[model samples]
Target: MSDNNEYQGRIVVITGASSGFGRGTALELAKRGASVVLAARSPEALTELAQECETAGGRAMAVPTDVSDRNAVAALTDKAVARFGRIDVWINGAGVAAVGRFDQVPLEDHEQVIRTDLLGVTYGSHHAMSHFRARGKGTLINIASALGKIPTPLYASYVASKFGVVGLGDALRQELGEEKITDIRVCTVMPMAHETEFFEHAGNYTGKKAVPIPPTYDPKTTIDELVRLVVEPEDEVITGWQGGPFSFLHRLMPKAIEKLMAGNTNAVQMGESMPAPKTSGIIHQPSKA
Candidate 1:
């Protein structure tokens, strides 16, 4: 049987909905007939996205939010419940990155990256778990990265944050199983670097244009897998054709993979042209794509 109509009238909450994977997934889910709650730091962008989703023949609400702030995230949950009664699925996709030598990146920028990427997921999981436990059913979808499983240079803090997300999801899933909570679900999606506004919004100390290291995948590929997970939940999904192989190799040949990744650090640092002077990018604020 087709699962296309399964999401009809279901309520979903997505962070980082203003742009990138979050935005793309929101639109696709809307088209699939899900009621979407869009949360991001950009109110204007969120409002515009909500209109698009409505035009796609689904209900949507925009809530400007800073996930780094626990209170703001809590309020986001409150507003979603107030508007849609209950959240059937929550996608914690809001994130920012800093691309540069670890020491060269500003201290504040590193801290902000952790706060937004790691702590943000922590907050979302906390609230979503509470609601799901009370209702005894819900899905938590955390958008992590392939980098989480295999470390890379020039993205130290980003690696740390994603690693935390992976750990958090595994722990949550294990606990739920231990408690025999069969209905509720926790899933983590790990995708290879994709074409997203992340490079543009990322804080750069590299002085060169930022691009995915190599073997970049399409954003749609990741989005489609995420949408599919809405109906078919898994403990963890590593998307992209190459993602699984790379992860496996990293496990079998940890030293070899580390050496190759270290060699590629120079490629990530050297781009076509010098990038603009360093700014905090979207770590501390919002940037429209």
Candidate 2:
């Protein structure tokens, strides 16, 4: 649990602030007196969120950005700095997933996932690290997934991207330590399938609607953990009770875990009813949602 007023006057930058965990985190932090910089592809949604933050008793700014574009991401950083002077916390919460059999999913769709989920994170970390190094104290939070450590079937590209994210966060942590930058913290968060807008925005080619696997946790489970890190920094955190057991099982019996995922692929990958047409979602274009 975090102390009351722990986030007061902190400057937090959150991507994917239009909805889901990013939106929740921004509101919760704002209520605690943190100024939040909201970034996403939807300007209208971001603006509305910023107003909501202000109503909660903290300052806020909205910068419409597509994380996949390095220039746009750079511009976003500039806007945040211009508005708040400095960023205390940077959370890479923007992500898109595609679900279908690996061979059946479009090649371009697979690449889109890599660009947004993996390279987008690279871009955020690159800019945030430069700023944090200059400031000498800051937190970089990379939102990975439980799938990063334990791969699941039918989400090949998403699994690949998240695996890369996990590796990137660890590598960055070590580099910071080697340079004796102990004041700057690099934290990675891995959560099991949770209730979020992820399924709605995800690209799909599975001929069925996308849905979170059973035992889905609430979005607050992840958001609360994110808020806690603002006060007590850590190297890595696996949110949600289910995620803890999944990580443990993966360590004890990797092969068995893989087999279990394979068996559960159908339920994890698609809904029973028919789905909308194949779409690349917001990966190739800005999200209107």
Score every model by TM-score. 0.97, 0.96
Winning model by TM-score: 1
- The digit string of per-residue lDDT tens for model 2 on 164-279 reads 99999999988987888889999999988898888878888888777776668999999999989987889989988977888888899999988887767676556464567877
Q: Give the candidate number with the greatest lDDT.
A: 1
What does the lDDT come to for candidate 1? 0.91
Candidate no. 2 TM-score: 0.96
lDDT of each: 0.91, 0.88
Candidate 2: residue pairs that collide: none
Query: What is model 1's C-alpha RMSD?
Result: 1.4
lDDT of 1 by residue, 1-289 (tens): 2376898998999999999899999999999899999999998999999999999989999999999999999999999999999999999999999988999999999999999999999999999999999999999999999988988888999999999999999999899989999899999999888888888889888878777777888899989988888888889899888989888999999999988887776665674446667767888889955
